[model samples]
Target: MTSLTSPTSGANRPARLGVQIAPQHAPYEKIRDTLTEVEALGADIAFNWDHFFPLSGDPDGLHFESWTMLAAWAEQTTTIQLGALVNCNSYRNADLQADMARTIDHISGGRFIFGTGAGWFERDYDEYGYEFGTPGSRLNALDDSLNRIEARWGKINPPPVHDIPVLIGGGGEKKTLRIVAQHADIWHSFGDPQVLEHKLGVLGEWCDKVGRDMSEIEISTELKTRTVEQADQLYDLGARLFTLGVSGPAYDLAPATDWLAWRDSKNA
Candidate 1:
């Protein structure tokens, strides 16, 4: 297995900007439009959460499966990278997940980052007939699945165009962070600067124990607002990838642009 490390060179490294397009709230065309606008505006990656139904509102509200939408986004966008914010590992077999990711990697010409996690969101499992086990069991499943994913990738006839970057999202102090150290190319968490600072500290401890360099694991988080001023603190704390989520139809680009300018200025 390859070491999951962040790229070096802090100041010269280009900040990554991404956006999550909520698939539950909009039709396909609207989702496509939002993706196009995000790409046009210089977003580095595009993502959608994996869930069978609407997570926030009505149980029966419009929602789409993650992989299908990713395949479409891979085909539609010319430059922006694409993937699920975190695919539920328990929902599919590890080998199947590997194949699906490889297919999408090809579809996107190797831009797919396979973000995954132990399945959460009880409603998804209970309603969809998947077993909703304890968190430990789910994490165990994720660990095994990741092993199979990497093994299967090696066995495939035509391998993925590039080694698909594995992204794992969760802030679990023990199991999740351990898995991130062992497997993830990127670690994503949602929290304020102080919380993230603490988590990074813990993550660093884990990296030391695992013999992995903490700087090699790219830190990613979602931004509710676009201002780089707020993001500056996170960047200082080692978060170089900032993502802003926009729901569709009116797919607002203002916040995305604000962050893009910040990224360019930093690069400049």
Candidate 2:
């Protein structure tokens, strides 16, 4: 992989802070409140997970569909960019996903990000009647879907207002990272610094093989702990989008605020 130290201007930089608000634990009003508060507090993005049932303990817990919730978030929050942390590629057809993203992009006045991934969560696929293939097969499907999504975007009547950033979440070194290098504008991975460093190396290697510049792909990770030092470490490793997840009705904003403050401090 190309080992350039600094990111290119106009796209890459020190990571921006964002928050993922789980829609399964809260009412619509609560979700809206959290989005508004996060955007007001200077979050660069607000995200929701895509799933029909709770991935946690109870399967029957309150949940909302991802695309629909994103449509609402698009209309509700004026400033913050909004998207699914990673929409499951198995859940929707490629053309349909492209159309949905395009619509939401316009709804947000060009503040929509198209975050997607190879489907996981066996329960989601089985319960939803989607084909739950092996990891490699799912990656193949994801790769195909991404191609279709791009092609469909070109064919759509009104193109997306902006070239909506595509965020792909996963750390599979072989296939997933290769896909990230080829397709993702942003790649989201979940792990500690050591792990992320290793994956970033692998991702870079994939970029090299594909003749893609690693610096062009933004690195993102979930912020399990809210600490300035941890954020700094991630920044040092070339991660430019730090994300923290909060499950609601409790809608805790402490971590989100802390990270946002750290982002502002860096920019300051």
Candidate 3:
């Protein structure tokens, strides 16, 4: 079995379940209630995405902010790990983010996963008045921000209770994959079995180039659009962490039970 320090150390382990309780088109009461149920449902992780507006349903839907809700969840839930599915590095300074994450880690007693990525949604930039820089430029900023974030983590008083695992979300081959090899404790991506296999090879190459152990990084993927059988295929290809993504308003978890059952069987 793998220790929490290296959650992805073993070639075989339980298929961990994660749910993104998308904070959009729903009241905080409903969102809060759903989060409680998320932990009770036995999901290994709970995530809320970072964005100003709803990505689905209505363009002007009721939506809560990400980090604030996370802080609340840190105080609310007892066990399920919480964080943004992918926090936008372009939205805030890395130093502030490091402090916020450290505080949440303490609040949750060390269950926060720092999942982050380069910002992609232009609407978020335009509406919030951030520069919609070129993709390459944004990637560069993310690369720089991670360094600052790590440096800040060291300097922050009352350091994080745990190692504060880093999860980098992206599939960009050149800059993003290299960053993952260097920094991520978990790498989340959206790809089918074939695509996942190909990306794993590319990631392995990046690990070789950087001289890091690929086995140390957990492989995470979304399960919102795939079937249990399809997820089994992904697992065969080295993806162990599966996230069932449900957008807000209802916070549907009925569909996730099947995946949870599958996870149980796989672990057994």
Candidate 4:
């Protein structure tokens, strides 16, 4: 794990907004349009999930690959930071992933967030001809892969524009938090204030064990199941990045606009 914290993810940074435009159940044009509109609407980050099929919707619904879309997004957007909500490490080689991330970072001029985790989608592995290993095995593999990724980044040609902030998304107390403490510049997970507080305490212990300043990691959570008041509570509990999940079809911005307004108010 490289000590790759971004100035934008540090304690001094403001509460940032991220939107995950789920690349499912929609045409490429619609997804691209939604992404363009999301950046225009003042999102600090834009994310897509790394899944081979729709997690919801019609089982075999329209879906797109994550990394390829990210490459396109690097060329498409200007200011918004881009990444997968959580890329599954089992699907790609560790060093290859690092190279791809570095390339996208250059294309986006240093605005790529490397969000990743151990894979959980059994179907993704089964369908893609990958071995669906046990949970513990997958996590151990993720642990190894991240170290390789960070090391590879250091050796890349015309190196990454920045240190390349790492965002680890998961709430598993034992393995995941330890990894986040060791590697992540941003720790994203699902929790209410109380849950988040507990997890933060656990993560703090891990940080202490790893000789890291807990404050060095920004707290991130999805806003899908949380209200504005609840989000305010999460903020009080130290969550600074709020992400809203966006999908195809209409890809409406009513909720995103509301949250962005709330973010500005808090930042103000």
Regions of candidate 4 where Cα sits further than 4 Å from its true position: 1-11
- Candidate 1 at 120: error in angstroms? 1.2
The positional error of residue 183 in candidate 4, measured at the CA in angstroms, is 0.3
lDDT of 1 by residue, 54-133 (tens): 77666677778899999999999888899998899989989999999999999999999999999889988988899998
Question: Comparing 1 and 4 by TM-score, which wins?
Answer: 4
lDDT of each: 0.84, 0.85, 0.88, 0.89
TM-score of each: 0.93, 0.93, 0.95, 0.95
Cα lDDT of candidate 3 equals 0.88
- Stretches of candidate 1 off by over 4 Å are 1-12
| Prediction 2 TM-score vs. true | 0.93
Instruction: Give the top-scoring candidate (lDDT).
Output: 4
Runs in model 3 deviating more than 4 A are 1-10
lDDT tens readout by residue for model 3, 1-268: 1111222343565689999998999899999999888899899999999999989899899998999999999999898999898999999998999999999999999999999999898999999999999999999999999999999999999999999999999999999999999999999988777677778888989999999998988899998778767787777767788998887777788888878988898888
Model 1 TM-score on a 0 to 1 scale: 0.93
| Model 3: residue 167 alpha-carbon error in angstroms | 0.6
Candidate 2 has its poorest 10 consecutive residues by lDDT at 1-10
How does candidate 1 score on lDDT?
Answer: 0.84
| Residue pairs of candidate 1 with colliding backbone atoms | 5-216, 6-216, 6-217
Q: What is the lDDT of residue 198 in candidate 4?
A: 78
